[model samples]
Target chain A: MEWFGANSFNFEFVSSVLQINNIQKSYGSVRALNGVSLQVPEGSVYGILGPNGSGKTTLLGILMSVLRAQHGSFDWFDGRYGDGYRKKIGCLLETPNFYQYLSGEENLRITVSISERGDEADIERVLKLVGLYERRKHRFATYSLGMKQRLAIGAALLGNPGVLVLDEPTNGLDPVGIAEIRDLIRSLRQAGHTIVIASHLLDEVEKVCTHVAILKKGNVLTDGPVTDVLMDEDVVELDATDREGLRSFLLTQSLTLETDKETGWIRLRFPKGQAKLEELNRTCMQQGIALTHLSLRRKKLETRFFELTND
Target chain B: MKIAPLLYTEWLKVRRYWAFWGIFALVLIAYPGISYLFYTGYQDIRSSNNKMDAMLKLMVGSPFGFPEVWHTLAYIASFLVFIPGVLVIMLITNEYQYRTQRQNILDGWKRDEFLWAKFWVVAALSILLTIVYALVVLVTGFVNPDMALAGIEVKSYYIGLFALITFNQLTIAFLFGFLLKRALLALGFFLFYFLIPENILIQLSRWRWHTGNWYHYLPMEASDRLIPPPPYLGEITNPADYKQMLQAIPEHILISVAYTGLFWLFCFWWLRRRDLT
Candidate 1:
């Protein structure tokens, strides 16, 4: 409560901006989401991470009210508002969905008009924010993939929405485009907006997300803060002069928790900051094993993602 | 949200739509062009003979006046009804093609508001066409020797009725567009329904069911009845012939209203039931 009260910068005092309970969706025989549930706290950058064909996009579609879920429900802002609650939440679902013949400025005008916020002042502001202000007059069909995605983000930013829901905002972009979008997302979060992103990019999730949920085959395997869920552990790769002897020796040591041996190196997993190279060397010396190659590696979200969703 | 802003959004989408503008220009040209053709053909007939029947000449010359304006403008308008029909189909289908309909729902528009925005567009279209029709009538009045401003009495009511008739035709297109979600397919079926299927049904009703005259009360036929052929029996404009033609106005109006209401109900039900995806 103290952290939520003091650190929370947004005006809303509510802890959970979104509460999704047991959301289930299916496309005919293929189940898109199976009993998925998660909560997004206020002022948190929430990332829904999964592989392709997982329930990430389906869940985002349902939250945007574009697709109907067969089961379960979700409430936004604690049900403080009715259907109009969508006005406070902006969304860019799936791809950049805009009228191709319309100019970027015109498309934003249309979005602002639909929002009924009664002004186009934010249109220019958002265009500038997305770095599309100079090309605001260009037709959407003429834009590159990066520009199209940026225009979509600008449209989503209209009316200064409190919650921004972006589904694969950086998909199909080059390295530079991806980096720009990542920076933009981080900047938006820094400005105190709750951002919910659904992505297959684990590196992006690690870089921008404060909290994350890993999904596979329509089921959420785990969800929590980034530190607890993904970056909580470290991996160690150590090899001895006698490889077979070191494998047997690692299985007997208390410091070595989970051990896997490849042809070249024996990999050991331990809690972050707990394992020391000198301590492992002492153990190797006592076991009559001479250490040849020893290297410490930090586990990335990619490694944890593979671990959780492998099943 | 106020409807004004929604309408503005709708306008923003269509104002720059080239196809919509192209169709609008086509309708504007086609209606007046058809009217002028009739006028020139009438003039040629009169010039070929010293006396080409006084009443026939009067009917042709006063094409903008009451009774004749209703027939001429309404028939001309129906010939171009497909223009607006295609426009509505494209407008509705473009949303589906681009998947902006999903974006719309996400942006806080109720599904009903989205539907209403299209209806508002229809309303604006009807008024614009009606004004053009009125302008054509005015030009016809200024040129024709038999038609003066005073002779065009009861013209405003028929113009309103013509606008309603056009809206009724557009509603058919709207229902098909919403249900089909593809412009080409909806337009194909729309043209097929109006150009061939309705005629087949009317003919089949007469031959197979022996439902003579009653087939005229069918939805499309009833709207067609609103604009019957001009009351000119070859070279005669007998009062009894005119009365017989104008007698079904009330019936056609009632049937059109009922059909429009039915189409609206179906549209509402379908929009509410179908997922945006």
Candidate 2:
């Protein structure tokens, strides 16, 4: 109360533009969103990474209020979602469901018309936005995967919403498509719109997401700034014939090593802010150890995900 | 202005199906066409008793809210229910059939808006059907100046009855459509019911068990209002109350209202509770 305009850490500037508090959904015996709590800060690119059937879609569905939260609450601070909040949010959740018989322009017209946004001008604006103005006259069925995905994005952008929620916005795209969508996400983020994406594509998330949440088996294992999660771990790797000798030496020296029998590769983890990887490499070489491969690793999301969920 | 978007969406949904246009044309033309044909049958059952005919022949200019108006509207629009019923099915059931409803939900419409958008479609149809009835009647007046033009009974009552008929037809369409997501299946069952089985059942209701009265509760019951009382309707009427019953010009009006209200109420209940996955 004392600092009404001040932004703190919890009540931080992005405390939560959109907050889901302790949501729990159970289908008879199957729990979906198990005690899930998340805060989507305003004007941030947030990614939710999970495997198939990991409850990403369910979470988005609940956010759009398509599926009601059986045991929790979702609050949106930027708009009036209490009754008419859906109007403010745009989404591209699944495969495009346009009238396949109609041309892209006609379909866009119908969608925008029904959307109750601007008039014919909005349709032209979206077609131009997706870079599909030339193919706007083609039927949606004839468009390629990239075009369809772009059109879906264009549809989500039809009303120029403050938040755009996309599920695998580039699931089937090639490198070019991925790059284009990444650029689009960047532009969207730059425009100060909140963008939340649920994707299985790690590199895509790594490139575009400012914050991320990981889910495995319907549980939100971890969520925070991407930089913080990625920068937390200090690890290194080595491939040596005397792996056993190296493990024994590392154990004696209070270092942790995990070996992969299939690849015969050994990974070593050390405490944070301690950069003694060069010293360790020097010791291995000086001891006449045949070091095949040597490298240091940051705490990547993949590592953190496996660390948290592998058990 | 906002309603335009809602109405625009309704138009987009309806324009895709040939059934909407085809059946609408059929209803718009069928009533007046049949009425003109009935003009040829004027002498066959023309009442001989001047007083009875004067009372029952349909007064043309008795003040607006007369019993005569409802009787005429009931007679004229009786055979028209089937068209609107099919339209209702097209309007509501198509969403479920094509997964458009779910997509619509994702496109930012709530379950209530979905329901409300559909209700607007039915309301729009009712207005169209009424205008067609008026047009046909108006054209018939040009062809035969002597034709009766008893005004619609109770403007407010007619409006309510209009709402009732629209709601009832859409609900029947909705109930069957909600259960089956296939357009062909919805259409096929609708055709089958309207054909031999339903007609035979109507006949059997009189000779079979007393439960035949429940026919009025079936989808056919509301549609039956579209067709005028058959010339031989008196054969099934009770001899004791025939005269008194025929005087009640507003027959079937209450049933239309009751049926529409119940359907709208039930649809909302089902929509709220059902899983949309």
Give TM-score values for chain A, per-prediction. 0.80, 0.76
> What is the fnat of model 1 with respect to the true interface contacts?
0.88
The DockQ of predicted model 2 stands at 0.35
User: What do the candidate models score in CA lDDT, each in turn?
Assistant: 0.80, 0.67
Superposed Cα deviation of residue B105, candidate 1 (Å): 1.8
The CAPRI category of model 2 is acceptable
Q: Pick the candidate with the highest DockQ.
A: 1
Which has the greatest TM-score? 1
TM-score (all chains, Cα) for each model: 0.86, 0.78
Interface RMSD of each: 1.1, 2.3
> Residue B248's C-alpha lDDT in candidate 1?
78
lDDT of 1 by residue, A1-311 (tens): 01011133223667999999999988889999999999999889999999998889889878877778899999999988777777778788888989999999998888877775425677877787778889989899999988888888778777667788999989767887788788877777877889999988888879999999998989998898888786566678888779888888777664454445444677777778776888888878988989988878656889989988786
- Judged by lDDT, which candidate is best? 1
